[model samples]
Target chain A: MFMAPPATDIAPRDPLLPRIVRLRGKRREIRGVWSLEVVAEEGEPLDFAPGQFSMLTAFGVGEVPVSVSGRTRDGIGLVYTIRAVGAVTAALCGLRTGAPLGLRGPFGAGWPLEEAAAREVTVIAGGLGLAPLRPAIEAVLAAGGRLVLLYGARGPSEILYPADLARWQSARRAQVEVTVDHAGPEWHGHVGVVTRLVPRARFDPDTALALVCGPEIMMRFAVSSLREAGLSDARIFLSMERNMKCAVGFCGHCQFGPHFVCRDGPVLGYDRLAPLLRIEEL
Target chain B: MEIHDLEEVLRGHPFFEGLEPQLARLVRGCARLQRFDPGQRLFREGEPAEHFYVLRRGRVALELSVPGHETLVFQTVDAGEIVGIAALVPPYRSLYDARAVARTVVIAIEARCIRDKCETDPRLGYELMKRLVPVLFQRLRATRLQLLDVYGAPGD
Candidate 1:
């Protein structure tokens, strides 16, 4: 029989355990950041909505919260288009194919995928924000809803996940518009913030749900733009970002007013967060 | 810069005052910069007490979980404050998780390093103890306020 270790001997090990299995993907260059389509190493199906996120940990370094980008049959794939900011992210940037990393949770509340099951859906992703909204778009298409995706980036160089986006657009025959802040020599698309594309799309917001994610500045503009486009606060949803350590509610790090972003959000309707959303600093 | 630069940033902090310059520098050396966006966690309950942190900017909320009930938010740590010092003492492990409520910056110092340095130099350790006691008292007071928030009658 194997002997058990003493309680004191195992003291102080990291408390968090990886709930979602992480799989390695062949890194592909997408705009300025590297894109990795991470699938579940364990084959557990990820049933998440548009704006839910997972906490990806590079052991011995740290963990970060990322949006789930794609939901496929083999396993749920996460498209990580990360900016090399901190120690953990910097270390993640150096990882190559077949490199192992830890995955924990499809944590936080996702877009109301279940609630919006039958409604028309509009998803707006600005810059790297596309990483999280990808799953929502996929879910809409799978559910056979009329879905439109509006993607905006700083320029041609910052667009993320070309192959996946192209496949979804062509296969589903969904409307996907690509906009840029500045166009390069080879670029031929609308040039402006993502909000500019709102006018071109046709979605009856009163009966539709609009999900938006991007930089805080962009999200603010997007929300207001949707409202201006006659979308009610309750009909529009926005994904909020903050540094989340524990994807669980146990950590108070991701609190906005009385809500925990890691638990209550990553996705919140404009009606719920509208008051705090106006508070510029928070 | 030396420890005084750290002290200036943490001016009015009770945990480092009256320390000898040399010893103060040793404590400061262990600290590093940390930053967080709105709605991020610094640590969680039941996690190892690895490092104690001092807030430089932003807000941190401390939350405690109670069985069969909603988790209670105990307190908020604002800018220019020190937290997680108790984790530096014996039986180190966080009692509650510390999290950032807004875009926050902090200085985190490894408690083990400070503990080792304190063991090697008792005199400096004594100064640290004196400075740290009042902070502990303040935490206790804040925790009491939280208890009232949790248990007191809604209108009371």
Candidate 2:
């Protein structure tokens, strides 16, 4: 059975002195996106599942909840694909190797891999949404089940993890179909909304479980498209986001209706979120 | 198939399935078998709308071009799907460049012939319009989603 991290363990450390971690390596994934590999300065590697996020504090700069993008197959370090979008994130992105950053819990429920076993898996990611879904994709592929990933970005230049996508496709680990909303010369792939790729994915809709993570509007449309393709709401999951201040449920910032995105989910069943997702500006 | 059997073959397609036999014959009358070599331009964007195609084999890419950039393929219509519905609409002009991505076979139906038949047979016109609506709606929905730029940065 899946177990969530204890709140006590993930709660901010005194809200003053957070656990310090050191960035071991970093690479620019694409323009405005950086992949940071960090390790605990002292102690075992941070334990996290696919879809979980960590509250990374850049000491004086501030903290932000960046999803754990990847874990080494042998599980040595945690990886985060950070988009330099805001103050905290831009600070984190600016850090160099060996920079000390505070780290918090790998909080939030993860993708339901246990339920995904023996079934075809469809992963739909848009823009930075791919960061959180990367681990799940790796897990699903490692488990040897059929996997299909429908990913979209604004343009070819914005697609994260191009090499990994190519590897996944060449290794036959997954059927990864990528699309861009806009493209220049030299891009031969599909150019349209990510949802357009849904119909082209090979899967048994009735037996497939779809894990979607993207902007809310994208997820909304993706869920509708999946439902249209015959996947029940119960079988489709979404990774939701809000103004998350606390990694635990205490803070109300991440609340969506009655649920705390920090605790009940960053990952939630579409059935549970369908009604709330429709409300404007919730 | 022989020209005499074209109606039977067209009827077998899901798009034409359950079409009235008489209407099917009339549609077949407007259609002619056409082949395109790989990478050939079937039609260019902004060209006068003259014909639409029901693909019989291979793929056709519907692409849009920005003046200085490479053309972007927004959608691809494969065998058994129809392309160039813009030919049937008012102010008719091809909306995107259609190119054969592979050696392709299609039933090319002249817009004038379809318009003439529709004007002569209201029932057939209604049926054709009914079928075309879904295709047009699907395209419109996709365009709406693209316009949303759903993959771009989130709102603050």
Candidate 3:
């Protein structure tokens, strides 16, 4: 069990504090029902493994945890697909380029990308679940490993990073497939839940690690779908979504069984989430 | 959708059964419909306030954790019952997690939106309070019973 540190020894950054070097929101756009990408200001360099998340603070409103979209030496992209139902998100929508914003950290234990080096990788994204897995896609591409991506969204408009999608399709380094919950007249892509896209990919579960993110219901379905496709619980991984106040595990808000979403993971193997995930509630 | 049409949809709900049409419409205007499959989480404990939902179809399980990390199902909501009223109170975070046991449909109204509208119209707010208070106390009573079960003989 992890214990909280002494308050004096660890003067954690106050999100509400007026720090001179502040991050600003470049723009906010609705990619789907509750998903938006906020390009934040460059403060300190963000060094995080793929699948870690940061807490976004909008002054006088409140703070929310969003996935670290990507990072380059120049700056990092903080992509948050917010369900615009609350005060912070409602205010977050109103923010523009150069508006003040607070950032806590790129916290949480990320996916074990290093542990699965030189292996076949299968990444599955359900609905807006793609937001957290974008970094891993970038990492896999950078490493030149054999990879496959299966993306599922509500529909065409709900699909994120279309330009990136196009680039991946053209480069053809990794096989990519997309599906939708409901299709419009323009959509000719696969029409079904993201789980359906898994069977189309060619991979050996023994040689591949599957990473999935999205709504808990969708993730549950995706895991079962992958297993049905011959993947085992040990080879499947998932990123969890829960309320986190202190991005660092100081608060118990993110606790799920023996693990905390902020500490042990926002990303964890199925071995952890499977049993708890099987529970009808929680 | 027109606010009035929204009210009619929720008026039949036991949670809002006695609410005036205008107030019911206000609730409806603030609501968004959500659909989830069986065994899906509706919300988790300690999550920041967002919306309160009324089940239209299916059932939702309310769960609380024990000392050993074992979760106990306190109750389940059938059609016409409300969930997430904790959003109406201050600090606006869930005290327990709720999940779906079947393909569920819910009318979720943003708590902030309803609260703001209520602040502007105290009469409507007063009526909502009248409805919610008893439900809150009843839940507390139910939780008390659950605690008794936990502390009582091995199989109660």
Candidate 4:
């Protein structure tokens, strides 16, 4: 049995002070997105599940919650994929190797991989949504479970981890189907929404577990398509996103109805979130 | 297979499920089995739409071409799916290229014959329209999602 990390019990009085870590390496994924490798400056590695996010602070510039994109099987260092959408993320993306930064808890629930054992797993990712799902993909592949990945991007130029995708496809580690919304003349791949590829995936709907991460609208459509394909709501999971402040539940910035995204989820069952997802600007 | 055998196949298809026996027979009258090799272009964009197909085996890709770049596949139609609905709708021209990606067998129905039958039999026309509406709506929804570029940067 794999040893899981102890859950955080005490709410930090100063969540920023004791959380400092150092960035070790960086790799650009696309135009504005990057994958940064980080490690603790003084202690043991941080253990995290696939869907959890860590609160990353850039000392002077503000802090933001970035999902832990990857972790060693031994639960060593962490990998974070950051999109330079705002000031804090932009700062985090700009830092070079050996840069000092603040890192907090690997908060929120993760994909229910234990329940998915021996069952077929379907992973659907849109845009940068692929980052948060990468860890799950790695775990599933390592376990030699039946896996299918349906990924969509803006175009060929915007695809993330092309090498990893190629390796997965070439090695037959998983059934990887990739699509783009649009592409130039040289592209000869699927050019439509990611949900369109879900029907083509080979899985026993009765025994399959689907994990989706993407824009809310995209996930909504993806979930609908999966349901039509015969998967139950209980077997469908989503990694949600919101403007988050404190990594813990104290700050109410990441509230979704009765649940706190930081603590209750970054990964949640679709059945629990469907109703709240319908309300506008909630 | 014989024409009667093809008719039996059509009857078994979900697309023709609940179709009136007489209408199914009429549709079968217009269908001719056609086979395509891999990489074969069944129809090209802007071509005058003459026939639509009920795919029976293998896969066909619907592709849109760009002037200076590669062809982008919009969708793939497998067994039991219909292709070239444009022949049934107005502006009778293919909007994209349909190419067989594998050895494919299809029951091709002449658009002119089907249209003539529809004009003569209002009931058949109504039933066909009702079924076609859902497929059209599905395509519309998929197109709308593509236009939103839901996979792109959230702010963009």
lDDT of each: 0.70, 0.85, 0.71, 0.86
All candidates: TM-score: 0.57, 0.89, 0.58, 0.86
lDDT of 2 by residue, B17-133 (tens): 799898998898898889999888889989988998988888787888877767777776777789998889987799889888788998889998999999999988999989888
RMSD of 2: 4.9
TM-score of 4: 0.86
| Minimal lDDT window, size 10, model 4 chain A | A11-20
- Candidate 2 interface RMS: 2.5
Candidate 1 lDDT by residue in tens digits, A1-282: 999876684454243686444546645465225655566665545555557777777768988887776654365466666666568876776677666777767677888887666888888888778878877777788888878788876556667777767876785537787766543323334444566577657788788888888776667767866887899988888889876888788878888888888888888888999899768777
Give the lDDT of residue A113 in candidate 1.
86
Ranking by lDDT: 4, 2, 3, 1
- The DockQ leader among the candidates is 2
Name the DockQ score for candidate 4. Answer: 0.48
Please list all clashing residue pairs in model 4, or write none if there are none.
A185-B69, A185-B70, A186-B69, A186-B70
Candidate 3 local lDDT, A1-282, one digit each (tens): 999976694577674343322333333334313333444344444466788887777789988887766653355445555555567866665666566667667788887788655777899886556767877888777778677899876556667777777787765568988765543323434544565566568898778989888767667767877887888898898998889888777778888888888888898999777788767657
Candidates arranged by TM-score, highest first: 2, 4, 3, 1
Candidate 4 per-residue lDDT, tens place, A1-282, comes to 999988887765475454778888888989999898888876577788888998899889988898989974346689999999888999999998999998887888999998765788999999999999988988888887878999998888999999888877864557999988876544656667898888779988999999999998999999989999999998999999987788678879899999999899989999999889889888
Per-residue lDDT of A1-282 in model 2, one digit per residue for the tens?
999966685554563346888998899998778999988887476788888988899878888888999975457789999988888889999999999999888889999998886898999999999999988888888888789999988888898899889888875657989888876535556667888888778899889999999988888888888988989999999999987787788879999999999999999998899899778888
- Enumerate residue pairs that collide in model 3: A34-A82, A35-A81, A36-A81
Clashes of each: 5, 1, 3, 4
Off by over 4 Å in 3: A1-43, A76-83, B1-156
Pairs with steric clashes in candidate 1: A243-B40, A253-B39, A253-B40, A253-B41, A254-B39
